[model samples]
Target: MADHAAARTTRSMTVPLVAFVAGAVVAVLLGVLGRVHDPTLSGTTDLGFRTVIEMKVVLATVIGALVVLQLLSALWLYGHLGRRPPSWLGTAHRVSGGLALLLTVFVGYSCLWALGLEVGTLPHGEPVPLRAVVHGVLGCAVFGAVVVKIVAVRARRAPGWFLPVAGGLLFTLLLVVVLTSAAWYVAARGWPGPAGY
Candidate 1:
């Protein structure tokens, strides 16, 4: 019994560690590509509004924070799935969930700003309609899932599988939103340019 429990714990930790490493590697590659290609991409800047560099910095920071929080959430959830949840696991789960929610909200707001859809004018700027809407909706969905998780936690009735389910769903939604927005941006204004700019 002791050996089995140890094996389960190890397996749980391994899964999240693998996921975190994979996500980090992909994000690094994307950042490198963006840096290499952003300068050469025409119309990367939103004229008469925020500078491109500022926007890039803001987006990069938000995205990086979100990714890190997601990894942390995954790790917490993995621990929750172990044979015995740690004493502080519930608190850790709540913290990670809150952070994830905040990150999703920031991503939605930033996406709107980047697409020039906010309630302000950047001269000659037009919103990327479908892409912006999709991104915003997906972000909201993730936020909603987080809200549900919070409510469950508060009620002290959260199911054992709830955390993992919520995490997986949010991750999937984020991936779809990013990928689709990228495709739309590429189709509209060629590759390696500011996506949804």
Candidate 2:
């Protein structure tokens, strides 16, 4: 009977274990893609922005905003906020979370496809900026964080603590991704124009 109980305990962990592995795979794949892919490095405008980089910053800012909503909604749901969250809060969280995920994925792919990693050498170009390099890496990490969070939410046997931890991690990663890219752009370029707002 004890042996059977132990086996059950181990079995219960399988979902989280799989989620962890999936997260690792996501991080590794994005890192590899960022490192190996050839980039366009074009100065073309996107969505009326002055450059592709500018468009990314705009999208990233929106993602950051959405993640803020996610954090607050999660907090309320977890009772970190006042007693009894509204019924609509859960629905709002889902909607915002979905939007945040979609935007994050879009920006990440755009970066990977358009700029690759901000590599040490850029053919005839100068050395890659450290900020750009960090931004690229953080972008890759965001996908990994997202994978873990999604798995925690979807898995039937995930531990009670798993979802909150995953949610917090996703929030932090997304916030940093925004800071490293969009915040830096705003700091240097002094806010994007009509397209950015």
Candidate 3:
């Protein structure tokens, strides 16, 4: 009986252990990629910078909301909400998660293509703002967390908590990215670039 109990504990930990290693690898790889990857600058738009910023902000906000829904759905599926989950709960979770991922991919590509990793508009000698630096770091982290979440979800051996943990981390990183960039842009330049300025 004792041997069986020990084996079960070991088995349960195997997935969590794998998840931890994968998460670490993901974070490092994403950071390196963000640093070394050159901006494509292929995203063409007749609209001005302010317009682009506004559109990105709107999309990000929507994505963030969807992520919240995803979290709730995950909780429901996991029975963490302390109630019976609806039949559609799983479908809702999957759909919202997919939508969020798709939107994030588009926004992330556009951002890197247009803005690169550099922080501010100041001259070369000027110091980079702390907010920009934080945003950039967190941006890379967002990619890592999302990848980790995906891997965890697909890992059949992984523990159920692994998915929720990874998803939560991704959501947090995304919120920081949105807050540091889009929210800051809106605050600095209003919703639409101060009306033709």
Candidate 4:
């Protein structure tokens, strides 16, 4: 009987073990993908201010806004807000989370397809600036962070604090991704006008 009980405990530990392994696999895959050269959008360039990059920036801004909502909704759900959460709060969190994920997929693909993965190197030209490198690194980190968060969600045996820590990490990585890319784009290019680069 004691042996059977010990076996059950061992099985339960597998949930977190699997989650950690999965997250590591995801991070490694992303790292490998970042090194592959995608020539699809190598020659593509828009002279207008409303370029694809500009659009990505706008989309990232929206995602950042949604993250704010995610945080608020999460706090409410967890009773950290010091007030009763509305019945719809949970639904709001789910919808926002889904939307954020979809938008992130779109933006991430757009970046990789349009600009491979380099910091100093141009999409097809010489090195432009250091911000590009920072942006590329942060973008990859975002993927890894997302994988970690998903693992935390699925790991039933994970500590109560793990979810929140994972959530915070995802949020921080996302914010850095936006700041390094979209925000930098806007700073270099005037609104609705093509960049002078």
Best by lDDT: 2
RMSD of 3: 3.5
Each model's TM-score, in the order given? 0.42, 0.89, 0.78, 0.79
- Write one digit per residue (lDDT tens) for candidate 2, span 110-182: 7888878766866788888887777777778778888899889987776787888788888888898899889
State the weakest 10-residue window (summed lDDT) of model 3. Answer: 41-50
1 versus 4: better TM-score goes to: 4
Candidate 1 TM-score, true structure as reference: 0.42
Backbone clash total for model 1 is 0
Error of 4 at 144 (Å): 1.9
What is candidate 1's CA lDDT for residue 143? 45
Whichever of 2 and 4 has more TM-score, that candidate is 2
Tens-digit per-residue lDDT, 1-197, candidate 3 = 99998887788778767766776776566556655667665663424544555667777878878877987888789888999998988988898889999988778766666665665444467877899778877776777777788777887766667777888889889888888877787788666544366
Residue-wise lDDT of candidate 1 within 1-197, one digit each (tens)?
A: 99998887666555444444554454344334332332332434533324443443444344445655665655655665456556775677567556655655554444434442222222379654565555545544544544444443343333455456646655676566655554444456444434355
List candidate 1 segments past 4 Å from native: 1-61, 72-100, 110-133, 180-197
lDDT of 4 by residue, 1-197 (tens): 99998887777666556765676676666656766856365554443435777768888888989988998899989999999999988988989998998899788877777776775556588886677777777787777777878877777766566788779988988888888876776787745444664
Residue pairs in candidate 4 whose N, alpha carbon or C atoms collide under 3 angstroms: 119-133
Clashing pairs in 3: none
Clashes of 3: 0
Residue 120, model 3: lDDT of: 45
